[model samples]
Target: MSAFARSFLKKSLLAASTLLLGMPALAEEAASASLSNPFICRRPSGAAGTITEFPLPTEESSPTSITVGPDLNLWFTQTGTGTIGRMTRDGAVTEFPLPTEYSIPQKITPGFDGNLWFTQLGVNQVGRITPKGVVTEFPLPSAGSSPYGIAAGLDGNLWFTQVTGNRIGRITPAGVVTEFPLPTPEAQPTAIALGAGGKLWFTEVRGNKVGAIATDGTLTEYTVPTANAGPSSITLGWDGAMWFTEQFAGKIGRIGADGTITEYALPDANSGPVDITVGPDGALWFVELRGNRVGRITVSGALTEYDVPTAGSQPAGIVFAPPGFLCVDPHLWFTERGSNQLGRIRAVTVP
Candidate 1:
């Protein structure tokens, strides 16, 4: 862990112990908690009673993203090691070295054609990997592009952010690439997800806006009401609005398809929300990299926070993994950037 994280953990542990000691009768009420340095949590569908933590190869290598691969295994990106890792439902782990040869792989997502697509933030290249672990890479058309986040587009292609290039890129399943520049320079688009409306939605970390692009590479930008909000990750919500995290401003934002934007403040002023996803339970779940918590924002904009066992752990990525009753496994899987551990949170029915 970073020195900052180590110190924060110490303080958090002290606080947790005090919280426990101060209420002797609360022992039975303490939720079951597990993590070497647990970072993020998700509750997979149908598997409501079990939680699983998938450890990384190292204690300091940050795993950045996780998604259910077409092969039915979980695929994640290791930003610290510049590798892609695969962990099967039965707990088998395999890894593939990144092809960029210069930069770390930042984000990863499932492509339309059943391959895993990822971005190389340091080298400006996009990569593809198959269920069998075959990897292919395509160099960005622009120099210093610094591709960050990626997601499958409705057009049977992969769309990604060129954070430094100030553009978004589209790559067909066959690996052909096309680039579209944003109207403003240095937008630093960070994360992207295919919107319900068949368009690609993304966050501009520097530009402080949520933008969209059609399959034809047309660009549209919507400014957030707050300044330096640092909008980071964007995802389609169950409610038909696009939900995003404002990393610096400590709020969640929603954008209508017509280009209107609304912001909701988190309970904490510095949650530093990074990535978000719509859960099966119909809540908007996101990682709080700074506040050290899992944030749940309801469709109606109600905010709830859950503290991870480890503090300052820097949860970065999240995904749902529902195991049936026969397997006895179900929960959400997430990654911790500061602790180099996987986090799992189970859903509890409200009393």
Candidate 2:
């Protein structure tokens, strides 16, 4: 078997053995990897089996956000097309028309009420779609506010950012939006996620800060140590901290519930880490957008980079698949913006 295939199998077997024995698993989940031990396979053959790319024919199209839909299909936004696209688990692709022109759809997420919610950046709107593809759009009160990132809040509301208006907006499942202005006007909040602590955590891209707003509208902000760090995306870390990516400073940052901030520099300068998510193995997994690679960092802050075989692939928006058999553990899925493809990594081993 090939080096990658063997490594994948080894990892899969290790995972299976641990599970069968009812022992606690400890290895960190990785999105991708290269073999360091020729005899020890690090990723399984079936895990890295095939990669598929889907192209949207719209002008200057790029995917902004992606999420698993209620139907188990992967749904994402096509910014340039003013449309949403869906990819089946078996690789079938379908596109749905948006309700407005120049919608510039940014982020797509599964809402509390089981609808697919997306941000319409250019048109200042939030959209929802049922499992059958019926779309409902809610217009933001502030024109040109540029609603960018979105997530389902703990209170069952859809929360998003106004990249231009410097505000956070909340929408009821019924499409009623109420805008909350951030303290620092024009801070340009980019992405948001719900914390385990029940607060909405987000990144202020232009303001260079990570902030949290309670479900009741109280806001707190934390400044990173590096200037112009450009905090872009935030997710709840398995280590019980909020982890965010510094798009400009090329670092990963951690913020505690009490507002303490720490930063970890990437091995490569200008790596431009963009999005992050909590892995099933309890590590933080992120996308190195400029480096065209997927990376994983343990709770202790150790960084490992995986080189993608395809150059300039631009990995973005990563997530771990729901648990399954040897063919599916630690499975990672991400977007390849430059190539317009969806990529997966399976049976990943840290060592």
lDDT of 2 by residue, 1-351 (tens): 335434433553454455444424432334453222123223334433233345545544566567766554678887767888887655667789887898888888877576789998888789998767899988888788998899988687889999998899999988788888999877999999988678999999888999998989999988888999999999987667899999999999999888889889998769899999866555788888898878888778988777665788787777755232332345667777776666665424433
TM-score of each: 0.82, 0.82
lDDT for each candidate structure: 0.76, 0.76
Task: Indicate the worst ten consecutive residues by lDDT in candidate 1.
Answer: 35-44
Runs of candidate 1 with Cα error greater than 4 angstroms are 1-52, 322-330, 348-351
* RMSD to native, candidate 2: 8.9
Candidate 2 residue pairs in backbone clash: 6-41, 7-41, 7-42, 7-43, 8-43, 8-44, 9-44
Query: Per-residue lDDT for 274-298 in model 1, tens only?
Result: 8888664566788899887877788
- In Å, residue 3's CA in model 1 sits off its true spot by 49
